[model samples]
Target: MNTSSEPGDSLEKQAGISLREARQTQLLKVFLVMSVIYTLYLAKTLFIPLVFSAFVALLLSPLVALGRKIYIPRTISAFVLIGLLIAPFSFLGVELVKPAERWMETLPKISAQITEQINEISEKFEQEQNQAEIQAEAERKQKEAEEASFFDNWFKDDEPEAKVEEVKEVKENVVTGQIKQGSIEIFLSLLASAPFLIAQMFGSVILILFLLIFGPVLFKIFIQDFPVVVDKERTVQLVGQIQKRLSNYIITISMINGLLGIATATAFYFLGVEDAILWGALVGMLNFVPYLGGLISCTILLMVGVVQYGLVSAAFLPPAVFLGINILESQFITPAVLGQSFRLNPLIIILWLAVMGWLWGVIGVLLAVPILVCIKIILEHLDVLPHWVKLLESEG
Candidate 1:
């Protein structure tokens, strides 16, 4: 009995040790993850431009290769492609400035007008409610009188306490003033940060040009240091697959978003929405961010519609049309075009977007999906991290 009990105790102690070891391993993993995230947040200014350049390089690498097949030098092809990419954006930026400024100047007035319209609707609703309540009260009193015995009537209090409701007033002028002040502050802050932002943009463009021209050569050199022929071949194949998957994803999504924007602008223009082109460009840019982007675009459209149409039934048309187009694009067009090539768990995508957004900002939110695609491609090609692949994969 003593020997059997000793063996059982030893088994229990071994189990306890294994549990402790597992807990330690998990803690280490958590710490490593936290450290990486903190580092990313700390170095965002440098990483943001670097990551953007790398992804852009991957996207344009195919075009550059095509140019090489035609005997165009990489440098010249890179410059030409970059110029083509920047031209339309620059034109759009120039075209949008006046409209953007006009809208900014009128924002306070728009806010006040929308508020006033809401107040009017609220007042009408309240009046109808008050009339219904009065009618119900009168009927209730009459029924009570009909049912009351003389003794009950004599026992009842002659007068009951009256309940008074406080009516809150919305001060449109005060709201407008606050909005105007806040806008002014925001504009000044943006003006102050313009130089830094421009510098980062310039750095990104230069880095992209360099990466587009020399990226392949650098990758080959890195692979050569692997020593074994099999390792070199595997590394090259891995890089190639990542580039292919990312390039296709970016190019297809960009085209889709561009078409979406064009459709949005055309619809808004026909609907007599002011600054239709600006809103179109905005929707296109914002669509890069999944989930949050469409919600924000719809909200802005709703407000703009209300302000423009002044609470009329037709006021919902702008956002309704925008929502319809978005539903078609996301649910129908995207699936048919992209299929499962870049699919990931929606939960994983949202979590990654949140992490990246917290670490960086709006640019991080835009880059999150592309980065995730690259990661998914890499993981699929490698045997390590099989569990991660399972975690990231979408369910059937």
Candidate 2:
């Protein structure tokens, strides 16, 4: 009887320790996860490329599969497709360069126009203010005699000329040469990283070629062995769905921008805005980045508007037009085409663009939405995350 009680107590003690140990083990795993997450944050430069490449792969997979369906060799199809895509891009590249060339030839003219417009607007404002001031001055003179009696008595009480001397001493003091300095270090840093743009473009083109050529092989390797408890078929299905959805997204967005560019360029040309084609192309391209794009377009329009229309309403017109088109796209076209399920929350999308812009700049902003879309899809399918949570995180 004593032996039986002692044995049971010993077993209970071991089991209690095992529970505590299990808890400690789980905590250790959580700590490791947190460390890894922080490490990724710190090492984002390297990681951004991987993320970009993965999303790019997801985008291009559909086209690759289409090529396969049509019985074209992967390498040939990739080359042909890329070549076709490159034509418009190459045209755009040419357009970007054209502004620089024209600037060289017409710098003096542009400077003169900008100066003339600024002076004209300033003078107009000054004239209006002067007219109002004259009217006020006349009014003040009529009232001055009435108001001066009390002041005059007060001034006589002080000394007759004391007030005049005080008035004479109150001269305006203007500060000169108060130039705020900008950091050469930051300027040089920006200059140094300018190469990254070229590197990114080259890297992307190469990545495209590489994926197109070896995508199937790479896909197999990537998913062949996994650490998680997901099924292989499910993995492939997710990838396929992601790929199809993303590629269509890329294609659709690209087309929308292209059409918008053409429409805007035509409008600009009709409005007699200089470099209409260039501005239009920029409007189309930059608008892909969301909030910032509209801002940039508006700024450019305001500058050109001052010269073109010279009216205050004219100054507001371009931005308002941009806002209107955006409203249309957001309300009707985008929802109908991209569908509600595929859309992203505006605030999250904007924040994503800003983060990416900070990390990799404009290029990153361009990719941010796509990368977020892919991540949202993966999170949506995960059972660990609830349906409501996924819906909130998703395009919904």
- How much lDDT does each candidate structure score? 0.85, 0.68
Q: Write the per-residue lDDT of candidate 1 for residues 1-396, one digit (tens) a residue.
A: 898799889999999999999999999999999999899999999899999988888889989999999999999999999999899999999999999888877776776676677767876887677667767776776688789887776775532113212333434456657877776777778779889999999999999999989988877776786555567776777778878877888999999999999999999998889899999999998898877889999999888888778777877898899999999999899989999767778888889999899999988999998888888888888877989988888663
TM-score of each: 0.82, 0.68
Deviation from truth (RMSD, Å), model 2: 7.5
Output the TM-score of candidate 2: 0.68
User: For every candidate structure, what is the RMSD over all alpha carbons to the true structure, in angstroms?
Assistant: 5.9, 7.5
Output the worst ten-in-a-row residue range by lDDT, candidate 1: 159-168
lDDT of 2 by residue, 86-128 (tens): 7978987886787746544443454455555555666577567
Q: Show pairs that collide, candidate 2.
A: none
Which pairs of residues collide in candidate 1?
none
lDDT of 1 at 165: 27
lDDT of 2: 0.68
